[model samples]
Target: MSYREERRADAAAQAEQNRKAAEARAAQEREDRRLELETKLKAKEIAAEQKRRDAEAKAELARKEAEAKRRQELADKKVRAQEKERQAAARRARFGRVAGWLKANPATLFVAFVMVASIVPAVISQVGALSSAKVHVMLAALLAAMLEGGAWAITFMGKQAEDAGRETRKYRIATWLTAAAAAAVNFWHGLEAYAEHPWVAVVLGGSSLFAIYIWDMKTHGSHGKTREERRQEKARKKHLADRRKHHKEIAEEADRLLSALPFESITEEQAFETAWQIKRGTQPGLSAEIFAQVTGARVQLGAAFELGEHVRPELVRAGMLARLYNPLPGRLAEGIPTLGPSVPVPALQQAPEGATALAGIGVYGSEGASEKACEKASESASGNAGGNGSRGRSDEELEALLPKALKIAAELVAEGNQISGAALSKRLGIRRDDARRLRDRVIAERKLKLVEGQADAAVGA
Candidate 1:
């Protein structure tokens, strides 16, 4: 009974211990599964967060790109708009000028053209009926008139530029028709003279034919033409017409300015040359001040020989007073100091050579002889009378006329008086740092004369 009880108790204790160990192992396995599930969920959440952030960043980048594109397009549009506006403004200005020219000289131009076409033919007929010598003279005159008339009509009518080109075409056609008709009439007369009096007609007809050949040759300024040649001729003529119109506008502007300035008398050629020079501004002689005066030009030379009171204002505004002012305009005659005419006083002479040379150098050749004479006389007299005898220019005068400090400094550099930066600084009385800058500037200025060339040496000689 005791052995059976002991065996049963031992088995019970072992069973209980085994059950506890299995329970602990099961608990541990459940905790491990829970931790794995939690770790997987956290990983999924982190991945989702990363994807969301990436999507947000991409959206922001796209928005920025679109904004940049829109801004670029707007800038381009603004630039295009500005360019278009500038072009339109230029066109309107050109048209306005053409309109004004036609309005101002309408009657004169029309009458001139009509007389040229009609009067020429009438005179030729009249002269032919008269003496033989008269006939030749009249024929020559007629030919000249015809050539000039054709050119003027073509040039003006083309520039009369209305919106429609139809009018210009009609005008051109009329000019050609008139030329043909005039030629036909001339041919008919030649034929009639030949038929009526064979001997005299031969001479007259030959003479007329010769005249015709001369006219065509001189007028066309070229050889015979083919179909392609004719097309090119038409294009060239159109180009010439455009040039003439531009010239006409410039001419009209000149006329208006001349009428306003009663003191000085400037020719159309002078005005044109001056205006062109001012506009180009490519030369060192033409400074900013001179350009300003020319661009703002509302004055021109007049028939009046004497300089007007307005000269002061113009010279002052032009910054040319220091160079060209005359002090005798408002001064007393006695105080002005009169010189005896022994060694040819500059004022006594009608013209001097220096003014002419200066004018040529300045490219202002259309200056009136009378104006040049006056200017030369005044300038020479003033320059000489103030300080010296016949030789002119006293030591005091020379000293007074010495170049300014800045001018001296510039001249030294221009003459290549220095090379290195330190040397240049000493020569120019400037700092070493400034000398480097000046050297750079001088190098950039392409036309600055750093050395006295043959031209200067010759001039000095």
Candidate 2:
């Protein structure tokens, strides 16, 4: 064969080898894809199995938790039932204890019974009284209860106070007052409702007082204040009330004193007395400062009396002197307003003829005084100048600003913007007069330039 045919044969073998290699490679890739698909199928099956197992486990857990919750609820119900039984037993025991106490204290039970029985009658009587007065039913009932309840409350408090060995005077007074008011109301009610029978009204009215009286007597008996003692207490209370009314500041001061001292170290009266001494300066009615003023005034009065001893003679002498003088004296004292006003001078007139009083001083050649007067005049003139020396714009500044203002005006005109004296004033920071002058110069130059331009144009033509 030829060399070209050999080269062609070698190239065909290489191409054939490449085609087989590419086919083998494609077959291997197809096998790899089949294995990968099988692996994904197995993984998906495993995941599905895991999800089924997790769902089963969760369902079992929920069933177990439900069973546990059922058992817990049963236990809680049993506990509540047991607790209810225990509470029932406790209530019974408490009721028995109260029954035992009531049985043991028959007298106390009887007293309670009596209180109830008495309360009903008194309350009914007072309520009836109030009802007859045309009060509201609820209000009448409340008022009746208040009167009866208040009286009994005071009576109860008095008993407690007696047991505690405290003063029951206030309680006794309060109870009696409440009882009296209630009795009066009942009396009025009965009298108004049953006008024919006074005894019925008396009985109704006495009913309110009778119960409270019994309670009061039982509570206080002989332990209460004696009549004399009560009178003394009332007098003492009046004295204190008067003191508080008349001297509120002093009463407040006394309270401060009482607070400052140890508890119960002094009585209220003692405290008030001490405060009065301190505040009123140990005087009952008058303060020390006021006393001092009064004494000082007395001393001044005595001094005035002593002065009168000698002043009377002087006064007599003055009267004689006054009588000796004539009413119209020829000579007038200088600078006295009542005597006559000082003479008003005529308009500027030349000094009367010859030598003036001060004229001779000039003839003596008072050069020092003249020099001083001239210096004063010059100083006054300098002072006046300093007082009002606000200078106007200098000629140079005005001239310089005038050129600048004209230039600015020309620019404004070129820009088709108007220029006026006020606008020039701001541009040059000059006075209105200076700005007006500058603006006028600008207008005059403009006219002159215009005229010159016309003349030139005419000449050229």
Model 2 lDDT tens row, 1-461: 99999999999998999999989999989989999999999999999999999999999999999999999999999999999999999999999999999888665676566667766877898888778778998999998989988888888898889789899899889988998898888888888878899888888788877777655545547468899999999998998899899999889999999999999999987888888888876634556674565444434432322222223465334334433452322333222222221111220111212111112111111233333333343333322211323354566766777667768877655544334444566666665445545655665566567668778999999
Against the hidden reference, what TM-scores do the models get?
A: 0.27, 0.28
Overall local distance difference test of candidate 2: 0.65
* Cα lDDT of model 1 by residue, 239-336, tens digit: 65764586665545555666776647776456655654455443313346644554232123211212221243542333333223422223221131
Q: lDDT values of the candidates?
A: 0.47, 0.65
| Predicted structure with the largest lDDT when compared to the true one | 2
Candidate 1: which stretches are off by over 4 Å?
A: 1-13, 96-461
Q: Which regions of candidate 2 are displaced past 4 Å?
A: 1-74, 105-113, 127-150, 195-199, 213-461
lDDT of model 2 at position 419? 43
Shift in Å, residue 246, candidate 2? 61
